[model samples]
Target: MTRISHITATAYSCPFDKQHQLAFGLGSNVKRDVVLVRVTSEEGLVGYGESHHGQHPTAMAEIIERGLAPLLIDCDPLDNEGIWERINRQQLVTHGLGAASMMALSGIDMALWDLKGKLLDQPIYRLLGGTRKKTRAYAGGLALGFLPPDTLQAEVADLLQQGYTAIKMRVGDTPARDAMRVGHIRQTFGDDLDIAVDAATRYSLGDIPEVIRYCEDNRVYWLEEPFTPDNLEAYAELRKRTAIPIAAGENHYGRYAFRSLFEARAISICQADLSKSGGFTELKKIADMASAFHIAMAPHTSHSVLSAAGNAHLLAAIPHGILFEADVAKVNPFRTELAQPPFGVVDGHIEPPHGPGLGIQIDETMLERYPAIAGPCYLPIERSAGPTG
Candidate 1:
């Protein structure tokens, strides 16, 4: 049995091609943020994973380094379940931890799964019991938003040309503004494209009625995160307001968090992030829970190959996986630069990366070219001014 020898985390960021904007409180995104983790086995096998660093790159690096790394040394890399429980018991249940701890554990858990795949000489999906080798995908660029209608249309056209049958656009502007953007998608493609909208949890119950109406009227596939994950009542009410499926879970922490959503019948689809929802262990539990409730699985893509490959593995294994999100950024250095052969789409589907593990190797030195910026993410609400600005 290969024992875990060491753990390390690195943070990176690159300025976007052009600044991007979000609705609700999020103002603009100046850079792409990422934090990556590496787990090494005593036999010298190395596996990589990506944490949710769009929000806290430096802090996540620190937590994984100081808080989690010490606990991982000498643990069996194959003891994924046991290590997960230990991390959960220590960082989650014991400390009453929240997002940071969960996010850090999520990355480490993925590293272990990757390490397992390497040790067994199998792809992570196969290790996860997958029958399929490829998974359906959708374009999920951070670029599409309530930008000028023509700008958004150009972004949509390119993705369509790339053979994506489905795509997601960001929302959360004034209802009428959001309607115009979503309405353009319907009119531009007529029925050729499947469109979904992510509100980024930017709306109140009052702000969402019109948004819900727009989604329904325009055949929006689903409305994602119209309310925060913690707001179950609002999510349940939002579901009742429209026939379109309600999707969330990226912001949700664990299977326990997802259970509350299930109990409320708040979400029609579960959009768990393998890295953010407690990696493979917790996500499998969440997927099973979603399956029992007849909910679809549409994973949220983190902006790196490590998480992207991880998402694909889980998507291929699960019975309920409906869609895999891919950031359609034509020039995303983050995705292409990290993995040996970065995950790519062919005819609107992603073949699970071929390798013993995630099929990705973190360019640890890439951290130097794109060091983490120290501050809150630029996404804002009410934009009165915050650390991001």
Candidate 2:
């Protein structure tokens, strides 16, 4: 038995340069933080996974090291479900730290899956019974954000040249400003390109109609997370009024919340994050549930190549997996230097890395080089907006 001999969650941070900084509805992304989970087996096999910082890298790392690791130290690494349930029952459902607990476990669970793949001598997609078919990739992450219309258009042009058929832009600056950006991109690119806008949970229920009008007019692929995940009523209400697909779920945790999203029929697209939504074990269940509801999934990858690679494998494996949110951030070391088999695009589609597990090799040197920076990655900034829900 390859018992979990050791587990550690180490947080790393890489600050953004002035050029690469992305100011969006979520505030400026001055730096990227990730909690890397490394799980060691008795037989010397080590697997790595990433937990989203959730704007608090140090706290997230503490959750893994001080909260979840003790409970999972001796558990079987291959029994992903059993491990998940054990944590859920023992801590998560009890007096555990809610989303933070899930965020911590997410990285650990992903490491377990990585270990499973290595143990079985198979890549994650193959283990999940998914073919290595190429999935469509969208240029996303902390780029294509709030900028002048011409500048945003130029950025979109660069992405198009890079062979991206689709791109997601940040909105919620204001109705007129957002519309101008979207309209400019639409006009410049014509109808062939797929444009998705992420509001980053910044909009109110009152802000829906204007967003929908431009989305419909420009034939936007989807309007994502105009409101926070807990605002189910707002999502449901917007869905009723718009032909544009309402997409969300990156901030949502677990299958239960997703089940509620499904039951409410709040969204036509699911954007679950493997790193935050309970890793591969829970996300697989969420993907299956989404398929039953006839909703297509586009896995969200906001951090390092671990989540990007994990999402690619899971998306390739799932029946209803639709698109891949390729991190197109200009200066993300976590994506560029921290890992390998870079999630590249070919003719605007990305196939899973062919190596065993996540097909990644982390550079430990990068960890030492990019030590975690203290304080919040995104500082709160008040924005002028209409009535909020």
Candidate 3:
């Protein structure tokens, strides 16, 4: 019958070469913790999945091992929908649907899909109705911040040389500095390259007009996350005021949150992360909804190889798929440690990965080498309360 026998999860923390600087967040030496879920069947075949553990590896692992594993064990792994439904019906856990619970579910759901693909002898994209087209990629996190203007120019040159037709730069250092950098990149790269800017939600509603105008004048393709996800009204205002499309939804999780964004007309480009948005189960729904609105999905990719692989397959499946975020950060685990570093960008396009399921193989040795180090890599400044009352 190929019943699900057991599910096991482990966490790993990998260090980055340097601090990853963003507008609202600062990550010192990319402390990436990945949760690897192993789903074993009665027939003895095993399928693997990875969840980007981010700041909560132990919590995520505990959820999978203690909370989810008990319910998942002895169930049929082939009945993905049934299993997913059972998990979703857990009132206690499903209420928030974020943080450790969702992360654990993401891992389990991926492993379930992986097992299904292995059982059916097909790749995940094929199972999702085959490829629509080659997944296109854009150079992401191209080292705009913490570098001199000349060094930034050199980095852009390297990205262009690496066959990237499009690239996104981190902004929000200072509006004037950002404008100068954008102008420099535009002038240097010319109008041939598609340049996008991400403020990482550091800007307020007042900052949007200037940023949008600057981006539009400089011929920037898109401006991402100008305001926080909670500021939908600001996003709506920004959308109304700007010619430059606003890209968001990476911070927003699930279809419910995205539907609100769509209803509000707050976002033009949807950048859902498979790892963060409840895995493929929910992300596919989100993609379909975005497609109905004629919105393009340029999925936000960072962290694990599973995310990259899963996103690549999803991109191949969705007709409205646009650009994939290729992390250009040197210390990114996606490039260094993750199982299948995505197909190298060739002429601005990424070829879909070919293998059963997500096509990612975990390096257990490497996984063990990087254990969880102390410190919250993404603690917000507002939450920096001390031990004293």
Question: Which candidate gets the maximum lDDT versus the true structure?
Answer: 2
lDDT of 3 at 55: 69
Residues 1-389, model 3: lDDT tens digits = 78898998876666554345332324233455567778899888888776656567766676788888899888988787778678777722447445556667777888888888888888888888867357768888434553456777898898788888888887765566677778888988799989988877878766666787689888889999888899999988887877788899888766788999999999899998876776778788899999889899998885666766777888888888888887776565545665744344567787666777766565666665677664455544332312211
Q: Each model's TM-score, in the order given?
A: 0.94, 0.97, 0.90
Evaluated at residue 174, the lDDT of candidate 1 is 68
- Candidate 2: tens digits of C-alpha lDDT, residues 204-301: 98877788888899998999999988999999999899889989999999999999999999999999998889999999999999999999999899
Superposed model 3: Cα runs more than 4 Å off: 17-30, 91-97, 340-343, 379-389
- Looking at candidate 2, the ten consecutive residues that score lowest on lDDT are 380-389
**Model 1 per-residue lDDT tens digits across residues 1-389:** 67889999988888754444333325666677888888999978888887887477898899999998898799988988899998888888877447788889999998888888889899888888885467778988565865678888888888888889998888776677788888988898987689988888888988876887888889998888888778999988877877898999989989888989898999999998877889888898899999999999998888788778888888888888988898876556778887655567789998787777887666665567887886655655453211211
Clashing pairs in 2: none
Between 1 and 2, whose TM-score is larger?
2
Rank the candidate models, highest lDDT first: 2, 1, 3
Clash total of candidate 3? 0
lDDT of each: 0.81, 0.88, 0.74
